[model samples]
Target: MAWLADAVVALVALLHVYILVLEMFLWDRPAGLRAFGQSLDAARASKVLAANQGLYNGFLAAGLLWGLWLGPAGFGVKVFFLACVAVAGLYGAATAARKILFVQTVPAAIGLALLFGARA
Candidate 1:
């Protein structure tokens, strides 16, 4: 059960890493533009902000990976990071796009559920 939870955590971390790359390095490129559904002019104008957001995503990934590295002892760390992801997802869903609920919130919620279930 714990392993499954950890796997989900790892996947979420990897997803964040991918998001980081897309936002930071490719925000104005075709792939990022397609993923974000923005015009080239809009993307270009927001590139700097996107990079900053990407850096935050990288930090979230780093925190999750760090928790994973600590094994069972990192339970609190994992929960904290997952909560952060959930909150961010909720905010993004409400303010930015509904897709964030599926992409970020759902996975984090599943991971959190598995984590708590494993403990029980």
Candidate 2:
């Protein structure tokens, strides 16, 4: 159980890091645009905004890593970050994109449940 929780946290952290790269560095590129289903012109226009969004993802990743480093205390950290991700996903789903709900929030929610249910 502990191992499962740890693995989930690590995976979430890795995902966030990937998100940071995609948003900050590749938002205007073909890969990033395709991932988010944006046109090249649209991606180029939104590069700065995507970079800012990427920074937030980096912060979330940092928080998860910090929690992972703390071992037992990592539960709380994971919950907090997951909640943040959930809220962000919900907001995105409502205003920006529907896919955010499933891709971002659902996994975080699952990980949060696993972390909370794991034996400490």
**How many clashes (backbone atoms < 3 Å, residues ≥3 apart in a chain or on different chains) does model 1 have?**
0
| Cα TM-score per model | 0.99, 0.93
Root-mean-square deviation of Cα positions for candidate 2 versus the true structure, in angstroms: 1.3
| lDDT of model 2, residue 60 | 90
Residue 114 alpha-carbon offset, candidate 2, angstroms: 0.8
Error of 1 at 75 (Å): 0.4
lDDT of each: 0.97, 0.87
Output the worst ten-in-a-row residue range by lDDT, candidate 2: 111-120
Can you give the lDDT of residue 31 in candidate 2? 81
State the lDDT of candidate 2 residue by residue for 13-54, as single tens digits.
788899999999999788898888999988988899999999
Question: Candidate 2 has what TM-score?
Answer: 0.93
For model 1, the superposed segments whose C-alpha errors exceed 4 Å read none
Question: Once superposed on the true structure, which residue ranges of model 2 sit more than 4 Å away at CA?
Answer: none
